[model samples]
Target chain A: MNNMKTIFLCLAILIFLVGGVSNAGTYLDSAHGNSTYGVDRTSTTQYATGHCAHCHEQHASIGGDEPSPDSPAGPDDYLLFSDNHTSQTVNFCFGCHRGTVGGYQTGGLVNRSYSYRAGGWTSDTLDNILQAFTYGPPASTTSSSHKLDDIKTFITGKWGYTANSNPCIACHNPHAVQGDPANSASSAKSSGTRGYPVSLPSDHADKYVWDVYGDDAGEKMSNYVYQAPYRSGSTSIYEPDGSTTTTDGTNLTDYVTLCTDCHHYSPTPVSTRLGNTNLRDIDWAASVHGGKASWSKTDADERKLPYKAEEKNYVLACTDCHEPHGSPNYCYLIRKEVNGATTAVAADTNTDWDTLCTRCHTYTHESNSCINCHYHGALHESNPNQPLF
Target chain B: MKKSLIYIVSIIFFIVLCSQVNAEVAGNCANCHTMHNSQSGSDMATYGGTSGNNPCLTRGDCIGCHAYDTSGTDNVVNIDGSLVPQVWHNGTKDLAAGNFKYIASNDNDRKGHNVAAIDPEDTAAMFGTNGAPGAENALGITAANFSCAGKYGCHGDRAVTDEIISVKGAHHADDGTIDGMSTGTSYRFLKGVLGLENTNTPWQNISPTDHNEYKGINGPDTTSSTTTPANATISGLCGECHGYYHGTNTTETGGTTSPWIRHPTDFSLPSIGEYASYTTYSIVAPVARTDVSAVSDTVNPGGTTDDIVMCLSCHGAHATNFYKLMRWEYDSTTLATALEGCNVCHTSKN
Candidate 1:
């Protein structure tokens, strides 16, 4: 009796160490059997017996002990109950995650669809994930959809991603979500792959994880922290007067490091593959928009910027004037359009140039009459002797 | 025998007439000289002179002799009561050539040249002030002073110091003709001064023809093209006092090109443009004569014979009411009429 008690205690300890057994409430578990196809169809598994049975079976069952007792099922490829129509890796996830599945109907999980609005899918049922992942116009066209198989091939071929890896699993870990929801107040949902140690073919080992600490317990987790690979090196923070202070390790919250990881050195190939990819980090360090003192508070006062600050130490971040996931205007410009008539033409009076400039410099007159002070432009344009403007 | 006697008498009369015509100081010897150096028991030489025991035998020093009396008239009187041209007159009269009287009464250094004894060296002008470009200090004329006659002075030998010594022979042997006279050849006894002569006696109330003609040049398109007509010009005389301001070369003033450089002195005005309209000389912006032969008997040369730019075109030879010795109030001139100081030549710029 003592030995039996000891064996039971040891088994319990082993189970706890290796993670507990999958149960009904879990993502892989089901409450009802697969044969019953009604509103209470709560199973993600096809056989409704165990977790492995959700995707595969030991042998094809015929008449007895089968959930679908009336149906003949002597053969199925890969031990799957149904045929794989789409060659995409994400299609497997889409089958149950789609609203037509048993999990959503039973109010077990939210229904998510990749079908775009133009394909007769209502905007109400669509998620932003689908919008960002979908490559097509507001429609569910097959050709326009980004195939996971193709992406997997391309990433492996171009970026040297491991051949065996699936594009969906590369960024998302399905089993264990790493972040603690209690510690964060961010609106952005944490990815399950957050703490996964990912080894790149390149020299660096990127652990896709947050530097969790007690000090940051109640702070909102930034989206940039999740996306950027953890890099260990000195990163310089610039001051308003072009001076810099170097700190050990990259600031995970900074967009400069986060966006430049894949974009900086590998721009030429990426730009060739995806047109209109703005590798902005290349220009950001020296640009006036980035942090350089191109505009001043005096200039701002002249233009009448409403929220004028006492100190001229303000610097702009990438998100200040741009939307990351596209906006209605071209280049995802946040406030005003920049394309306008050239400086010489008198007809440029109606251009939005002033409106764009006045985003910071608000007091400058929004007209095409710059001739009094900027006389060189007009003089150069008029004088044939002076070819330069 | 009667014809010979008549010829001899005529020859003697001609010699006496020539002697009087050449005389600059024609008066009784006693009026200017005192051999004993004593008069009425007082030492005349030591009593009234800049230096003690005045050996030149003059009444006073250069300043004293030329300065006006308390009643504002000439201090020195000739035997015939004809007064010499006083260089330093009181402000009650505006003399022909200009006077140093304004310097003392106004106490304005810019009112006159700040000659020694008449006034102190021009403190404001030594390093230049009031927008006027400075004189070339490299030439060792950091301060302006005057001598009676020498290179540094204005009369007979500009380099000499003692006025009576340098111009001693000139006073007694001066002939008032452009060609025949050696001493007074430099128009108004300025020694080597070259200019066209006019008929204003004692130098006052000058008209275009009555004014002293300044030497200048016609054109080879630009003033800087040739160096032939430089040193003898009236502008060159002013350049001796203010050296860096002479050239038509733009680089000298840290500028770019011709005409745009320092104003083109001694350069001919273009006859085809707005300059042609200035046929009647404006007294405010007078040009000089490039051809000295063009001046004859007339007291007013009517047309464009005076179209060449000279130093005096923008400035007065003597004192004026304007700053920088400018002939007119350049700042007060307006752009509306285009008939102002600079606009008189730069017609289209406004």
Candidate 2:
């Protein structure tokens, strides 16, 4: 019994370090799994004992249940402690981190809850229409989770039904994962054969090239992208700003093409990282890093940016100006400056619709409302040169 | 016979004397300066004494016809003594008084005239406030204020050339012009009261080589064809001034690119369109957004290529309606229509 106690304790510590069994299980090779949990020579089963269940358990749902099925008593398939799909702590990952679990909640309050129906997500694009961190009444399974599941079921079931399909996890993690996933595309490899649709972490080697945009759905699971002047440049490569490129991995275009699962604008070979289906999302349209227009881009004429055409080169990606998933500002995105202040430009305030307006700050006009400028009155009615309504 | 001859000689002398005085008033400044050294001063009403610096003008020289039109001419400040009533009209002569001739000051170089009007204004501030000077606000010309709400173009009119004009006066005078002054093609101080000598033209044809593609300083490298005019690359010339419209949310207004890249009228922007069919129970979808894919409703982001608004169609440098300084009548909204702006001139409506 003493030895058994030691074994369980060691397994618990191992699970915590590898961020639970879900990821540790992904590295079940001769090199990683053995080192993490000590190989059970008697059993080398897939999804054995130490997997997703070792670290996470969904419970105390959005509203239905309090500490619903709290651990030790969970489900069979994915280790759902309860209906976390509908938690007041909307973000399943925020439950333990945002001061919920005792003794383990010490790294300051991590506000992880997000509104799936706000701004770009909802019908209201107005700035004051809603708040960003309003702990919405525990997501009634009907409003949030069901809508997503229903969409996901259709996406996984059909190939090309809707021009603009709503694939649930297309932009989401569902697991509320923090930090990097081990089998992350960086260290992943393709495990399954080509043509069929099964991808293991190792199968995703980084040869992410493309004829027309890209074709990676798992790219969202990775943290790298190509940083160049033109998105369509021949020299484009997968890059995640602040990281270096490696010739050691396979740049799999097939896996990255998965991004198109939701970017259903057209019928292209490769899927895009942005929403526009037929056309690109205009990422390079105004993507400047740190809000300064003079940045290096492979397609840019130069970086000395004058006040007009190609005046300042832009760097891009949602993460360039925002947090991992979403933020407090407009559409939960990021920007360089806000409402005139420069220092601490990106994070000074929540990314709001108004914050988005200030991104093009020097633009002068009659109202602070974005509708007055970009949309400006009604179509064909408002004068183009003059923005005054 | 001797007595009749003496009467005829006296009559001839009177005719010659009268012609001499009329000739003096008809010519340009040289007419007055030709004899400024000896004047029997006449004005006791509105004229101030001429200083050595003002050799071209004399006391009350502009008092009669111009006296009422240029209410502050030679001595007063504004036209009606009230700045609000300052007149900016042109083409017609400044003849509110009984005498009505071109009442321009003898010396346009304000120093040659009176103090009521300011000496000069800065013209760079008028062209969209992003640093592109336009008609009437042409640089190197004399203006009254740097912040003149210098107007140009009109809204809701078909495109026209040389339609731009300018308005002018002195200090205590209006600042910017409601009409255009010049567009790299025109200049101030033409021979006539109005510039260009009345041969109409606002913006002049410029060589891209002489000016920068985006800065209007040096020409950019582009292929030219017989069908297209010389130096007619849209990127080089058009972007030098309207670069603000092209900047993304990340870029500030006035930012430039080698080739201009304007916004394609979408949701990320305000509802500002030529005529919006999107308000108050109008089931029109919103403008398209780059980030948004799905929405509460499906017909979102409005239309893309078929129904989009571009910068060139709705705007012409020389055509407009309001104050003759805009491109369209945005204030008017004809309901339940695709409206106009982008779809107007680009009639690919299939």
Candidate 3:
């Protein structure tokens, strides 16, 4: 009886271990794992894309030689070539995702900005991620971007960020990150690939879901209330590809909900680029751009054609006037192009709002006057300060 | 003849029952075990070790199979059809027992258990004597006897001296439920210890709903010299080696009651006051359950039999990135933001 029981238990244990087989379907369909253009798995003609060897070196060295750009100390954990991150610019993911300088880039890649990709706005497509982050310095001096160092520090302190972790993983799940979808003219103009690129930063370890921002019942724009903005001249056609129908579900992503995962009411991060000043908290649900808020005592006649079409009551997505990555126009990541217009919004001093704000509203007031009452914490501020400290 | 015939029928019934059970370690046998340790004119041993040196016919040693030096962000990796959990992972998500990544990276003794095979002994003043701080007088855990597994260590048979030999047959043994009857059936292979193993997330990802259920006894009576008590609790497993920490000796654990010297273990959480707010189980400061049959997402604290304070509530079993292997930033957290690890139970102290 004892021996029979023992045999049964062994069989059970074996079944349990085998049950942990996970699929790489999400990664296989991503841009980095696309076999036709992805990184060389073993060599030019070897395993190719979708192979685990592209990022992971299980034996520490490949073909009896260590992989390039490895840490001098030793091989990194999880058999990666280098550490996850060492500095703001020195991230492991940027090794292949970067373009032109500092980091190497794999060929046949199409990396575009959020405005051009998702919003269907005419804007400069970024060559690499480094180009996006390096917008403020030398290239477009006064432009602002998300401080990677600040993200690294904040996430490390709050989350379970280890020595080998990359801060980018907080918002981006590399394995399951999708690209902008096709059909740029549809209101359902989804972001590339099938899955959503961004994730809830706090829930960093959750399994990557393919359609996190899908057009499903509880997904994408359906999770929140939103109204699609109008195109430049066409009042019938809406933004996100000049669609005739407004995308309340199935196509548009809820940028307000996504960005506010970190930029919301509390735990405001201190930006290293901004001399350690606390980032301003945003209450987008109560803002004028948010459809629920009152627009009384405001000039609707001063608005642009797109704004005039809806009388400035259409709820705005964060990408409606801002770029997620980096932008040529400073104003703290204000989009270079807005409402399908070709004319680029010029970069100005931190206080100036007309360069970007005037794209939708014809504000001829003082440079910083528009932001005084039209900001995130507008009503509560005793003294409204400039953006980016 | 009738008894022998019945035994054959019992064996057949058991085989069918075993076929339906889920196992912990599976996949190709050659992935872990090697008959000769040689493959296709080249050595097949992992962790840079020679072919035939590893014990139990394994391709790599304990640390070699469990951990590796890497900068990648993976807590678990696929090893030939098997998902192997890493103890020294570089990822943000460490397993429930904890990670040994800090021991090699930081070289700080306080960050991890100073396994002799992984790193050297603790050179700090408190452990400079080469003896564990809270070890019992009879079984003094010195540097000479310390290792990952042996008679002196946590895992495997305590009666055996050889590390690999102590845990022989454990990996292949049938570990259905943690009954603590055998080494493999024990909680995480800890001999004679009982607790519900976290199968969800494979012990890598932890949350309020998904985590290990630890065993504990409410209100431990320890006024005399009782070192190795067969309590079957998770705290009792720690007390088997570090006995003084769980005792009530005035010079050691101070007193068992409120105005105590050292922190108390095997005590029930008070339901009233700020502690009551901790009705939800925290992955940071986890309380042990009185009943280890199942894992509870909620905590019934303050005079309840559930939610017993254990040593793991304050410290990790293997390693962490904080000083003293704390589950949180104990050294850096201030009084203003006292809602971290320690303040979870001792609410008013903040």
Q: Write down the C-alpha DockQ for each prediction.
A: 0.00, 0.00, 0.02
On residues A85-121, what C-alpha lDDT tens digit does candidate 2 reach at each position?
3322333333333332331222222222111110011
Q: Residue B66 CA error for candidate 1 (Å)? A: 2.8
Q: Write the per-residue lDDT of candidate 3 for residues A324-348, one digit (tens) a residue.
A: 7677676468776566454343534
Those runs of model 1 whose alpha carbons end farther than 4 Å from true positions after fitting are A1-389, B1-23, B30-56, B70-82, B91-93, B122-144, B179-183, B218-230, B248-250, B253-257, B293-305, B330-350
The lDDT values for all models are 0.39, 0.25, 0.62
Local lDDT at A215 for model 3? 36
Q: In model 2, which regions exceed 4 Å deviation? A: A1-52, A55-79, A87-168, A171-178, A181-315, A321-324, A330-361, A366-368, A371-389, B1-350
lDDT of 2 at A332: 24
User: Which one wins on lDDT?
Assistant: 3
- What fraction of the real A-B contacts shows up in model 3? 0.00
**Which scores better on lDDT, 2 or 3?**
3
lDDT string for model 2 (B278-307, tens) is 321111111222212112122111332112
Better of 1 and 3 by DockQ: 3
